[model samples]
Structures are given as C-alpha cells and as structure tokens.
Target: MTPDAAQAWLEKNFAPWVLALSPRVTGIGPGGAVLEIPVTDAVARVGGIVCGQALATLADTAMVLACAGELGEFVPVATTNLETRFLTAARGQAVRCEARVIRAGRALIFAEARLSSLPEDKPVAAASATFFRP
Candidate 1:
C-alpha cells in the first residue's frame, strides 16, 4: 500500500486510544512498513520515559500495517501472539518502528518489529508477533 493509504487505514481502523498516540506512517512497501510516534506526555510515564505499553502498541500497529502491505490490501486479521522486549528507555524522543513480515502462510503471518528513539536512533525495543487470517 502507499503511505497515504496506509495512514488513512490507520486513522480509520485503529481504536481511539491507539490513534491518540499520533502514529504516522512514514513508509510502506512490499511486506514492510515504517511508523513513527511522538514521545508526548500522553505516552510518557512518571519518570518521563516512554512506557512499554505504548511501545508494544506501536509495534503491533506497525506490524499490522506491514501485513497489509504484504497482502497488497487491508484484510481482517487477529493477533495470536505478541512478544515485546525492552532494550532501553526512550526518553523525550519520538519513537520509530520498522516492522516487516517474516513469513506469510495460508493462515498465519509472522512478523517482527524494532523500535528506536528518533534523532539519537538508539534502540529502544523489539517485538515479534503472530497473526491469524480468518
């Protein structure tokens, strides 16, 4: 899918709270997508670090877009499993996630995502997810 279509899909399909993160689809190509979320107060914890939940959400959302790009269109899919690992704290910087489809079978899709703190480009988190196409 094109970047503009991906952005519109995100805005129309995601939940309100997920959209509140202000995720922007920077790029989308075959089997992969790039998304960015600003590190605003809404996503920060008491210590000013971006929370794990928000990062995980971004990862999952990015992966979904990656799947759409892989399929060449949007289709209903459900997350069967999602694993996230926090490598470092993201403080006061926007987060960027690069997600790609690792494998796509008839019924399942495997994907992975890496998130980095923008500007500095420090690795912040990684994620892998399984999605079931029903």
Candidate 2:
C-alpha cells in the first residue's frame, strides 16, 4: 500500500488508546511498514523506561499495517494471537518498529516485527503475530 493509504488506515482503524501512544507511520511499502513511537513519561513504566505493554501494542499494530500493506489496501483483520519478547529497555529515544508479513494465506496471515531504539540490526523487542483476515 502507499504511504498515504497506510496513514489513513492507521487513523481510522486503530484504537483510541493505541492512537494515544503517538505512533507515526514513517514508511509503508508493499508487505512492510515502519512506525516510530516516541518515548514519553506516560508511555514509560519504571525508571523512565518504555513499557512492555506499549511495545506489544505497537508490535501488533505494526503487523496489521504490514498485512494491510501487503494486501494493497486495508482489510479488516483481528489479532488472533501475538507473542512478544522484550529483550532490553527503551529509554529516551523513539522506538522504531519495522514489520513485514512473512506469509499470508486465505484466512490467516503471519507477521513479525522488531522494535528498536537504534538503526542497527539489534532489536529491543521482537514480536510475531497471527491475524484473522476478512
């Protein structure tokens, strides 16, 4: 999907709380999307570190965007399941989320993402999610 289409989808489909997380759609291409979530005090848990719940929510949202991008528009999908592994703490910088669809079938889609504070290959959080597509 195009970047503008993705941005519209994010604005229309995401939950209010998720939107309140202040995730910005940085880039969108077929089968992939990049989102940046700024770390704020409200999103941080203890010691000024980004919360795991926020990371997981971002991951799930990114996956949905990826699947929608791959489909070349928005398709209503629900999160069937999501698994997240938090590897490190995200401090001051905005966390970037890169998500892509690994495989998509008629009824289900598999997607994965990495949340990182750096541009390097390392990820602070890794997530895999399954979606029930409409």
Candidate 3:
C-alpha cells in the first residue's frame, strides 16, 4: 500500500493506545515496512533512553504492516509471539523501525525487525515475531 494509505489504516484500525505512538510509514514494499516512531519523554525511561516496551510496540506494529503489505492489503492479524533483544540505550527523540517478513504462508507468518535511533545510525533493538490471521 501507499504510505498515505498505510497512515490512514493505522489511524483507523489500531486501538487508541497503539495509535498514540504516532507512527508514520516512511516506506513499504512487498515484504517490508519502515516506520518512524516518535520518542517523547513520556516514552523514555530514566537517563532519557527510550524504553524497551515502546520499541517492542513499534516492532510489533511494523510487522503487521509488513505482512499486510506483502499480501497487498491491510487485514487484521494477531501477534502470536514477539521476542525482542535490547542492544543499547537509544537516546534520541525519534526512532525508526524496519520490519521484514521472513516468511508468509496460509496460516502463520514470521517477521524480523530492527530499531534504531534516527541520525545515530546504530541499532538499539532487534525483534522477531509470529503473526496469524485471526
């Protein structure tokens, strides 16, 4: 889907709390999506580092879009499982996530994602997840 369509889908489809992340789809492909997440003080932990939970949210949400993009439509999918590894503290005000669909089938789909603080050019977290249409 186009970036504009993706943004509209995010606003209309996600729950209120998830919508508050202020995700903007920067790019999308058949099996990938790039999203920018706003990092405010509210989402940051002590020492001004963005919290892991916030990054995980970004990763999970991005994977959903990545899978839908591969399918050429936006459809409801449940995240069955997500595993995240925090690499380093991200100290920026904006972070980006790149999610790629590792494999997609009739039932379950697997994806991997990377999170990084923008302009810092270093990864802060990595995630893998499974999703299924429900």
Candidate 4:
C-alpha cells in the first residue's frame, strides 16, 4: 500500500487508547513500518516516564498495521502471542516504534518491533509477536 493509504489506516483502525497515545506513522513498506509517539503527561506514568504498557501496545498495533500494508489491505487478525522486553526507561522526547514483519503465512504472521528514543542507539523496549490471520 501507498504511504498515504497506510497513514489513513493508522488514523482509522488503531484502538482508541493507541490513538490517544498520539502515534504518527512516518513510513510504511512491504515488511516494515515506523511509528512515533510524542512524550506527554498523559502517555507517561509517574515521574514522567513513558509507560512500558503503552510501548508494548504501540508495538503490537503498529505491526498489525504494517502487516495490513504489506497485504495491501486490512485483514482481521488476533494476537496469539506477544513477548515484550523493556530495556530502559524513556524519559523525554518522543519515542519511535519500528516494526517489521518477520514472516507471513496463510494463517499466521510473525513480527518484531523496537521502541527507542530519538538519537538513542539502544532500544528502550523490544517485542516479538505472532498473530493469527483470518
């Protein structure tokens, strides 16, 4: 799908909580997508740290949309497994979640995502997920 189409899907199909996190779709391609979430009081937990749960949810949501882009349209899918690892805390600035499809099969898809802060070489969190495509 075209970048515009991906952006439109991000705006339309993402969950209300995900949308409230204010993620912006920066790029979309056959196997990868980039999403940026601005740091705000609402998205952060106590002490102004970005919540790990939000990061995980963003990763999963972005990967689903990326898979949809690669398929050229939306397909109903359910998460079968999701594993998230928090490497560090995100304190300031926006965090970027980059998701890539590892593989896609007839009934399942595998994906990975990295969440990092701007100019940081290390990821704050990483996630691997499997989705049951229907």
Report every candidate's CA lDDT: 0.95, 0.87, 0.90, 0.83
Instruction: Estimate, for each residue in 31-85, the C-alpha lDDT of model 3 and write its tens digit.
Output: 9999998778878889889888889999999999999888899989999999999
lDDT of 4 by residue, 1-134 (tens): 76677777777876787789888888888888888888898889888888888888888988887788667677777999999999888866888889999999999999999989765645789999999986
- lDDT tens per residue, model 1, 54-101: 999999999999999999999878999999999989875799999999
- Which should have the higher lDDT, number 2 or number 3? 3
- Candidate 3 global lDDT: 0.90
Judging by TM-score against the true structure, name the best candidate. 1
* TM-score, prediction 1: 0.97
Q: What is the lDDT of residue 105 in candidate 2?
A: 93
Worst 10 residues of 3 by lDDT: 14-23
Q: Give one digit per residue, the lDDT tens place, for model 2 in 95-128.
A: 8999999999999999999999744535789999
* Models ranked on TM-score: 1, 3, 2, 4
- Residue runs of model 3 more than 4 Å from their true location after superposition: none
Global lDDT for candidate 2?
0.87
